[model samples]
Target: MGMTLVRSLFLIIHQKMSTSSSAILTPVGVRGMNVLDRAKFLRNIKIPVLKVADEKLSKITPICKQYFLKLENFKPVQSVSGEKLKCIHMNPEKIGAWTDLSEIDRKSLKEHSVNEDNFIMKDIELSYENWSYGTIFKAVLPENEDIVSGFTQVGHIIHLNLKDHLLQYRPLIGQVLVNKIKSCRTVVNKSSTIDNTYRNFNMEVIAGEENFLVTVKENLCNFTFDFSKVYWNSRLGQEHERILNFLKPGDVLFDVFCGVGPFAIPAVKKKCKVYANDLNPDSFKWLNHNAKTNKLNMALFKSYNLDGKDFILTVFKEYITNYCLGKEKLEKGAKIHVTMNLPAIAVEFLKCYKGLIEDEELLEKFDCEIIVYVYCFAAGTDVLAVAKSMVIDNIGCDISDNIIDIFDVRNVSPKKEMIRVGFKLGKEVIFSAKDCVSEPPKKKLCVDN
Candidate 1:
């Protein structure tokens, strides 16, 4: 009770919010109580509150404001002693007795016709019972364990990747999360790493509804998809915006792994023609549905359900072929942007462009530049160096001069990181790839209806 109330009041008075709470640990989980038990997280304590008349409440609060409880949604005024009065919170450290009161405090009390006679200690419930998911989780976690409060939210679902030590309390964590977050109706844990082709992992519903399909909005576009079937990182919302911001009204977007069109649909509304593809059929289905959901220009947005390698090869060939024959067209001041966002293996897919155009001679005829933004996970102190080396090794050509920018997109683990290596797709490297021998087989083009 003592520790709980003190820490709560201290953190509140200092205005330390949940942002700084994750790094902190609980020295006081509740005495003799099982930390795993949610019911054990209650504490009750009391502090002194100065009683002021209804008429003097507003006038007196500003003067002794420093001592107030400072809690959110706290109603300081109450019905007491058969009359309405305001209760100004106080503590031993600030003020206890009349003699210990500060000169200003003494003056405020005297002017308000209040004194030690009106000072009273009231009970305060200082417990995790009222704490948020962040606060409660931090309090229950073992001291020195890194908190796992960071989660990726997709619609009403909260996705958590718990560390090994945190697994023991997964149920508690999930239940608290589902209960605390109004929009969250489901909580799941990624049971394995995303090593599968679709970039989604096997997961277990730790709490709430078992439904996996949901709808969420991002970048002014509505996305509805099965969370268990596809890959969507909520943290990449800004990354999506960053890529979209770089395009002009008539620019072209080629999303090799479009996964429900996070990058594709928005570009369509931006008036940029989008050619998006995903190997996952579910992703392809939703990509088409989301385009309709946003009421976008279907003629401006085309989709395909092909393997990433095949998608890039067909799209690149068509893009260059149109430029050469004036079949399909790109307007002036509009660039061609290719996004390969599968961070784990997207670098390998860059080989799709090797010897891609047998003739980029049309490249010199156009005033535009073709930009490929390829993402990969690199583990090293210098992520950019690792990412560059990966791209060079796979493409069989040094593209140092072609690099537009190499961004440390986000951290995937303690050491591994997701990096976006963007560069100009010029002719020098497009002619050949020594390491890449796997070519796309001759077949009918796979287009999504």
Candidate 2:
């Protein structure tokens, strides 16, 4: 009323702005959870707009275009009066009320007969769709509480590690993710820490499809396995590629504690004879399936279900029988590489390698060099030094001189690293350098048909 009917127009807009339901709060659903009430997540804001008559829109638009609302995917031209009048949104950042306009602004707009009646409130609705994921997610959550920040993708699955405080909102978080992320077909939250023996963790499907069988492609090889039953870390793709880089055609690979052959299948494709094994029966099953799925020669890709130490000995037992005893000299250009990847306690399996074989005359018959890569978790200011000492203590041999290289793979957590301790296995280590078992364990060692 202060600036005639035009000022009254804004007062009328604020009165009815609270009732505007601008867009759909699209809900998502899964088996055990209710649909998310996205309306609760949307924040209401009313920005002023300049109402233009259909006849005058073209003439007024160009002059007032700079003041138009500039939100992503939002149409600056809209109808908000419950009447279908095409109006131009004015940025709240630019002006909040009629008094906010400069004298120059008033004179320019009035030249085209636009006044306070033209200055009406446009109800602005914002949802998670309006901003970045973190922005909207934080907006929905209570202030100062932990935000569920990120997730790992395995095939079509989104794997989340939720903290205790965020556990109650897991369903809502899962639904929001499945709705927002295009590639996500399923969402799972880790239910507990990893089972130390199998390396697989318990998980609950929070949203979308319920399948846990996933197919992942790495180093140009396709590997399929039950993600819930076996352990697979997509973050270790680079580590897999690094090990592959060391192999050549016709080399022999012993992947002790291998989980579904992320390394073994690819090594066989490179013409290396791969002896892959896992303690977990489920992992052993899929390892066989993936090797066949990738079409590796069954003769070249040998799979076994045995503990880490027994698997190590079995591989060497097969190697001696097939490559050393009958043959006059070992394959000239070939090398024997053993990879023990159970980082939680793999270095201890080095005991199986110390004095692995004791026939001195037979050892002299083997000419190929033996190398072992042991993965372990160690923490200290000097990670490499700590890892080296750990290896020395477990293998029970002075391998300081025979050590090839110690590689820092990645950080498992704060101050903890997944380190690779690689070294040449001297005949001393394998032929009783230290006082270890002089005889191999009596177990089934073979080339299974």
Model 2, range 341-397, lDDT digits (tens) per residue?
Answer: 877777767777776676777776655687889988888999999999988888887
Score each candidate by Cα lDDT: 0.73, 0.72
Question: Can you write out model 1's per-residue Cα lDDT over 1-449, one digit (the tens) per residue?
Answer: 11232233234222222333222222144322223465565555466778778888777777777765543335445557666766776644455556667787777678778877888878766555456555665556554555553355777887777778778777777787777767779999885466566666678898999999998778888899999988777778889999999988999999988999989999999999999998888899888999998999888988999988777667767777777677877786778999988776777777677777666466565445789999888887898999999997777677899998999987776768889999998767664433435643223222110
- List ranges where model 2 is wrong by over 4 Å: 1-35, 46-123, 145-150, 328-331, 433-449
Pairs that collide, model 2: 6-117
Error of model 1, residue 168, in angstroms: 2.1
Steric overlap count per candidate: 0, 1
